[model samples]
Target: MTTATATTQAPAPAGAAAGGNTLAGTRTLIRFNLRRDRVRLPVWILALFLGTLATAGNYKELYADPKDRAGVVETMDSPAGLAMSGPRHYLDDYNFGSMLGHQMLGFMAVLVGLMSVLIITRHTRTEEETNRAELVRSTVVGRHAHLAAALCVAVLANLVLALLLAFGLSGMGIDGIDLSGSLLYGFDHAAVGIVFAAVAAITAQITAHSRGASGMALAVIGVAYVLRAAGDVGSNGALSWLSPIGWVQRTYVYVDNRWWPLLLCLALAVLCAAAGFVLSTRRDVGAGLRATRLGRPVASDALGRPFGFALRLHRGMLIGFGAGLFLMGVMYGSILGDAEDMLQDIDEIQEALQEIGGATIAESFASMVMVIITVVAVVYVVMAALRPRAEETSGRAEPLLATGLSRTRWVGSHLAVAMTGGTVLLLLAGLGFGISGAASTGDSGLFLKLVGAALAYAPALWVTVGVAVVFFGWFPRASAAAWIVPVYAFVVGYLGQILQFPDWMNNLSPLGHVPQLPAADLSWTPLVLLTLIAAALVWLGLEGFRRRDLETN
Candidate 1:
């Protein structure tokens, strides 16, 4: 027997000490990622800035008088208002600056959290899944370098967003909003962003899949928001202390302007980064703390039928969506129960509604809440339709197509699930809102009225789904266009309310056409017209899908 000499493979160089990779190299990677996301990142920042400015402008206009401000404070101090927003301390000022501390703060926190999660996940797990991380790791870079760089990018983005918001709000003529307070507020918001980015970084290190990492990070954000909301509503400062959101809110800029809470945020961020770096050292390249197990080689009986398979794939998500919508609806509806009490104390609020094209206080409040729910429904629809795109990109579509399933049948299965599921979710939300509102008002008729009003927004929601379908079929490469379409609708619908834009401009949003419940006479004509438009768009999308090449990439 001839003995074969085995040549041992060489090990990779240790490369400059761990976490000591060339900063310039990491910076280069960061710049490249920024370049790729130039349009998107800037647009997000601009949107946030614009949103803040718009809110500042509206608050200035609505609470111009002391009586108006006092009324707002009284109403906001109520249980319903407290549940919906933060404490009403600044409401006493009746100035745009005061309102910013309450209204804009929560929204800014959410924006920061969202930007951090998206940015970190994009750089960490997303890059790894696309094999970009492997190519970069082959260089002399350390394992933690990418994460460090991504965190740096996220921090910079937060800084820029904070500065933009401060400038935007100041430009809107907000009074008594000193630069010091504004800067502190902005820094606190940015600090929260960094902390969440660290959280995402840690999640990415522990999860084997990008989806898992993204989901984990988002779940944390949701939890933080919920904790803060509960604490704020219940006046339990202890619970607030448990949440980063609460920490940021406690900053109370323009009111107390406490700086200590921000230090907590910074400490938590540093600790999370340290933990992530230590964990990274223990894991091999291209792997996570938990390894993913291979799925079954054969399809289960539940996945045998096209519709069954679609349902199986989407059941968890559908249920979650329905529950969330229902809860939101109930929350909003419950708040509206106090509208009578709220309006009784705030004549200015009522007058402002009448001036803004609303016929009654109830109608105006219902319209505002309905518009918000409609936007949420649009989001559900968009996410639903994007499921097919996700399956395609994840390579899961290939196996399903490899079976005897025809392309149209496979596509239709998912699309049917999305449309039907979205409709059901919206209806559930409407029912929840309507029932809660009716219960609170001791008026059974209000239930059906609110449901009808919510249903009226359905055609617009379907239109968004139709847009996603069209993009999925024809512009597969630009399927992100689907996300942009609904975002545009959202901007159009809400920005007008925030900025007090002209009627003609507001009319551009489809949801704007829906009659304000309890305020305007319900008309079938506009609803029918919207339905027809939705049908046309759906048909166009299907036609495009049929003509285009079946894309899996």
Candidate 2:
């Protein structure tokens, strides 16, 4: 007892840094991440840059009138404005480019942030979940290197995105854009992205699985948007400070061109990433700070069945999608009241919709929003339909198939969930929109009209399901390629109306064929024919699933 000297060993190098250089392989990993994201990063950057450029270029023409400028101010100050665009930071004068920043900056920041989150998660938590992290770690890879690599790639992407925005805005030769202001605006978007990339890095360390990490990161994004919306509309400018998107707006790009906010973003990003590095060293490979909870030791009888198991697998995703869509619906619905009133100032947007869609301007606008919602719902269903392929490739379906359960029943159970879950989610979104619309107008009768409009797209959604089912059954490896269908439909259906594409190209979209309901006449011909086509595709897909061997990775 007397000889017991308290020998406190030097505190182990605070976590993963225990391995001397925690970022030993960070540069290498960054190179790999860049290669992996070459296609994806460019696509995201171009989509946002081009969209922002196009919108900005149009502002001079779109709102040249003094009255139109005032209308833009009014629209920005409206509740719908609060919900759609964060806040009007540039209310001093008609700084058209600055006004454009207020309208599009908040949402674009969100998109950029989401891209950051996905990029980080794909390289970090997703790799860990797939055991790829362990494989990498087995070599001389540093503990903090993966995260550092992910962040580096996201940062590079953000820088490129900023340059693209700056160059695009500056090159437009628009009088509204000042070089300094354009640079600020572009960098502001990049700042927002890097901050969220840091947030994703931290989030990736919290959950054991990529899905949970993604969900948490996404939840943060949603909460940020809502918070920003609340602060902007409720006259609580202080509240806006709480949100990342709000922070982006606070940058005051194109207005005073504030540089201070970028510093704040940088600080937060650095802090979060440092914390993530700490977290990386503390946890074991494949484990999280918030570890996955243990499941019941015993299985219920329902777990033994196919449909029950399928439902069990998909319930979380369906709930998440439903909730997100419902929120989207509420936001969209809140703005419909302003559709007719606001456009008196700038009716060209209205005229364009009415011209392209052959419907009343107000009704066409509402229909457009409704159809977009349906397309999102279709995306959910298509993903759901491909679950069997995911399960099969993951080796989870092998056991299920080993039992007496036929492949048809096993696969069909996922299809069943796709159908039911898709319908429920679509209806939920519709209900949210309808209820919000009615409440806003004090005309509770609008509930049915909006809900019916949403449900009307069910056949269109099923068409996507049919196509995805065919891909899953026939070309399981290329099932993810099915996402192109809805995305293509949405782009063609929505953008085509703006670009005034040929009717043939527009009609190619299944969603385009659906009558714009609640404002336009409903026809049974397209619905019936689309449903029939869906049924045939579903049969073919299932038949292909029957004939093919399991295409497990």
Which predicted model would earn the best TM-score?
Answer: 2
TM-score of each: 0.87, 0.91
Q: Tens digit of lDDT per residue, candidate 1, span 1-553? A: 9999999986556444344653436777788778877987887778777767766666766666767667667777866676566654555554556577776676578677878888888888877876678777777776667888888889888999888766655555567676767777678778889989999989988876676776778778877877777777775456767889888878888777788999999999999988888887778666889877787999788688888888877776677678778988887888776776666644445554564455445656877777777777777678778778878776778887788887678777877787788778778988999888888777788788788877777776776777788888778878777776556666666555554567886666677776766557788888788778877777777777768765643
CA-lDDT, candidates in order? 0.75, 0.82
Superposition TM-score, candidate 1 onto the true structure: 0.87
Q: Residue 470 lDDT in model 2?
A: 92
lDDT of 2: 0.82
Give residue 321's lDDT in candidate 1 (0 to 100).
71
Q: State the lDDT at 350 in candidate 1.
A: 58
